[model samples]
Target: MSNSYFQSDLLSEFDRLHQQVASLFGGFPYSVRSDRYGAFPQLNVGSTDDTVEIVAFVPGVQADQLNVSIDKGVLTISGERAPAFGKDEGDESRRYRQERFTGAFRRIIELPAAADPDKVSARYVNGCLTISVGKAEASKPRAITVQ
Candidate 1:
């Protein structure tokens, strides 16, 4: 076979293997970035000159139900959402449809090297959890004057 043809065949095989692996884990919605399809508490991450900001949309979770922490440059957000229809909903067979997510969930975010773990702050307001991690002093931008 020509070199070009052999390379194309190898690439196609690799692509097929990737698809098979993805299919095996298709049932799981969790991913490292926490942005996978159907992942709970969608997150938006951005960085400013002095801080890294993260916002998680959790419409039904309360402030007390959420927990945020940073360890070894990894930020972890975990919490539980109670069922909407109360603990006792007559019989399980009576329920026809349920779309809401109700249960414990944990999402881990890897922080940049410049993020200062000691300067992290988190707040939950209006169904949104906002987390701010201050950048290290050396990482902040500074204007240098020419001599």
Candidate 2:
């Protein structure tokens, strides 16, 4: 029998097929992260016994430029960020590199079923937008006593 140099493993073939299937479906798989890669205003989500906390890192954006709202258990954050360097009509300069995100952006977050839409609050400070959604009374932890 001749020795074969190339070998294809079952696991490797499965991984390759998965990638092809994912790409065929628009390259987006269901995940907890943002819908698209490199989404602006990266967020950190956490929870406490009383509330669900969401923090969005948005530097160089003013508080007045942000809009936060909740509808049907979905939290939406929309805002516009102006360019750092304003363009002048008379000055003609070409930008070599622009990394910062500018213009309108909207981020949607799905809240848990226990999240009370009526009890929601948001505040923006130090370029960070913090949103808190109170959990339903029924969802709160309680001590049970044996009768």
Candidate 3:
């Protein structure tokens, strides 16, 4: 009979609808959605006064196997990792547990508006890929002139 009661009922109804939709779709979660959040090659992005710094945690992948590129203000990181178990393994060899991820993976990162595509550099060292994109001169912060 109170306003708070009505709000609570409405919120519960929305929650029930969400559960029903998730069940209908076989209980898919938002975090696993590739379009929403990239699932491979975890990335850390930051920005300084003049440059945007990006670090991708990608182990077991060599520099030759990885590729980094920027196009239309989007940075793409792609690569492949070979399977730990090789075909040479005999039938006696059994894989009781396999947790490592293998095969090809690609992740697209939308760069900020200030990122300059032409002034970008990348390097892979110690299993980490670091990329730095210079910001546009107009986008960099400047001290205002005081009258």
Residue-by-residue lDDT tens digits, candidate 2, 61-94: 8998899998888888889888877473444677
Which of 2 and 3 is the better model by TM-score? Answer: 2
lDDT of 3 by residue, 15-90 (tens): 7887676556542322212233325677777889999998888889989999998888888889997776756344
Which residue pairs collide in model 1, if any?
A: none
State candidate 2's TM-score. Answer: 0.75
**Which candidate's lDDT is highest?**
1
User: Which parts of model 3 have CA positions greater than 4 angstroms off?
Assistant: 1-38, 88-92
Model 2 residue-pair collision total: 0
Candidate 2 Cα outliers beyond 4 Å, as residue runs? 1-35, 86-91
CA error at residue 127 for candidate 2, angstroms = 0.5
Lowest lDDT 10-residue stretch of candidate 3: 27-36
Q: What is the TM-score of each candidate against the true structure?
A: 0.73, 0.75, 0.71
- Count clashes in each candidate, considering only residues at least 3 apart in sequence or on different chains: 0, 0, 0
CA lDDT, every prediction?
Answer: 0.82, 0.80, 0.78
lDDT of 1 by residue, 66-88 (tens): 99988888888899988777445
Measured by C-alpha RMSD in angstroms, how accurate is candidate 2? 6.1
